[model samples]
Target: MKGKISLDLTEGSWTASGGLTFTKASDGRTLRFTGAHGDLAQRSMLVDATVGDEATLPVDLSTYELDMTKITVTMPSVNSPGSVEGRPFSTTLKPDGAAVFSRAFGTSPVPTGSSLATLAGRVDVVPGLG
Candidate 1:
């Protein structure tokens, strides 16, 4: 399956637009996002034992207990540009064709004591026949 994904930050005025794909596998499923660029260049992968059975087309965050080590984020830097690797996170594919990703940090970055980042927006899903 293929789709378009978008995300906006709750704490700041940052956004990302991208394309998403889901490929079936014997073990489980593989979810991928690409064409993403904005305040931060974002790309993600979720390799879980389930194919998001709870997820419905055009909405619902295919819930999964993602492998945290597989997540990565790239930030723009003046001196040196690099990626911050390996952070605990979870994702919720919203019902309105959007996906929400929340990252948890060991230390609180926001005074409100929420997640380090909360990204939510629409994702257009297009089903493909096997």
Candidate 2:
């Protein structure tokens, strides 16, 4: 079986119930998720970054403290429970490259409860010699 790598995140559900969790789904690569807050930030973070709209994300594989060629994600829903609004949401990676999804609906102030305004995405590391 192939190893998987990913990062997960959540909002509102931090103290009592909800929270984000980032893990390597496949042993493809190692990723990190750093946000403004611990909880209201990303509950879980992964590569395989997918968006729900047609947006463009900047790619620079020379700053993330890592190295890579391409970064893709599963398009996020603009109108969903944990979707984000606005087009072109970006991320700053380390050692290598970065990516972002736009028109998200979960990038706003989170509400209170186990359920929160969520923004989920992923990043896929192009096969490379590690």
Candidate 3:
């Protein structure tokens, strides 16, 4: 992500701009992404999320306005061919948090790709999890 972020939204809130690419390990499908980041920040005490067309959407919420929500996105998925075709994803970050996503909303603190794979041997495709 590349953009200016102001801690105070009275000054500014957040910014998202980057072309992200990743490969799905299960099927070895490489995916590339680029899109406008729709972000919003409003003064709120309560947080809410929803799921499916009913969808259990991926979300990141380690902290919200000085509180630990512990709700972070774990998996960004697609199983069959074009599973996500014409699908849309949305996310929310409440007060006092930073989200580094444009078209990608993965919240795994574990940095991915080859460098990570090198650090932890064969970590890309976990045994049982696969």
Candidate 4:
């Protein structure tokens, strides 16, 4: 089955829009993600750089397995101008139904200063009919 996954960053004004294609398997299910594409806008603090525009980042889908509550995905190292780019990152999804999604990035000091860092909000999953 094919579907779209959308995420919203709760701490700030960043949102992620992406697509996922799932295939049924003997063990469980396999999910492939297109990418995490979205926009970022800073509304609280003033910065020395531009704060709003289109952003596209690759998500690692090789290690994902369908689960009851949680699924982990990676964000490859990015080097885009005027955007938050760094070494490869990963986030986990704990979805309640197909509308709300909550996620966190990495396993260290915690994500700070970017929407991709910490995310929590609604995700609209639209399934495609076969």
Candidate 5:
């Protein structure tokens, strides 16, 4: 649940343009999403993602299992001029064993911990457990 996530940036094809210009500003650049490699760790629940695309993974968040619900995307700030931050978004798991995740900014997006209370059902089950 709590660990470092490293994205394989080399595997994906990212396009870079320019940043804002006009007055004391560099040309605004846009880094679009391309591809990804999820769940690097064998114990972790990995999910592959792409730009303009969405993916879902059944993460077992119970009993300290490795579950990756989202990604931490770092991008240049358009509003703040120059900065970056975590943009956690929605990740839903369906009753039919399907999980749906999204990344709007085309960057690494993390799962919303606040909305994961219900998603904590993918834990491992013991053989003799009732």
Candidate 6:
């Protein structure tokens, strides 16, 4: 998750550019996303990090001071013009450092509503790590 990013909560959008990688700690299988471009905002973030080998999943984002959760969401579709009770998530990612069907997914603690956003920039994503 090293690179540059711009967030616009008012617009409910975000953009990212950098390198991303997903590592499977159980077997040391790394899925790297190079020259990554991320998208996130509101309650949902779409990331298209290229997958590869040799990466680390046990990453500590707390050191970056960037909190993905508690992000401002102002979408009218969610039935809650604004709320921080939910976060973006992905239901995709294979056990072999790959994503299934679509490179898209959503997270848990769902607010039982609708959401969408972009986290622009290259980012490392570990399944179940967030």
- Among the numbered candidates, top lDDT falls to 1
lDDT of 3: 0.27
Candidate 3 RMSD to the real structure? 19.7
What lDDT would each prediction earn against the true structure? 0.33, 0.27, 0.27, 0.27, 0.26, 0.32
Sequence-dependent TM-score of model 4? 0.23
**Candidate 1's C-alpha lDDT?**
0.33
Task: Please give, for residues 1-130, the per-residue lDDT of candidate 6 as tens digits.
Answer: 3322233332233344566554555654444443322223323334444324323332111101134563543433434332232244333222222231122222222222222122222233222214
In angstroms, the error of model 2 at 84 is 17
Question: How high is the lDDT of residue 22 in model 4?
Answer: 36
Per-residue C-alpha lDDT of model 5 across residues 34-125, encoded as one tens digit per residue: 22222334322222222232343223321112233432334324443222122343333322112222322322223434233222221111
Candidate RMSDs in order: 14.9, 19.9, 19.7, 18.5, 19.8, 14.3
Question: Residue 84 deviation, candidate 1, in Å?
Answer: 6.6
Best of the candidates, TM-score: 6
Clashes within 3 Å, all models in order: 8, 59, 3, 0, 12, 23
Kindly report which residue pairs in candidate 1 clash with one another.
60-93, 60-94, 60-95, 61-92, 61-93, 97-123, 98-121, 98-122
How do the residues 36-115 of candidate 3 rate in per-residue lDDT, one tens digit apiece? Answer: 23232532212122221122233333222222132121222354211111112223343222232222233432332211
The TM-scores of all predictions, comma-separated, are 0.22, 0.17, 0.23, 0.23, 0.18, 0.27
Give the CA lDDT, 0 to 100, for residue 104 in model 6: 20
Residue 67: error of model 3 in Å?
Answer: 6.6
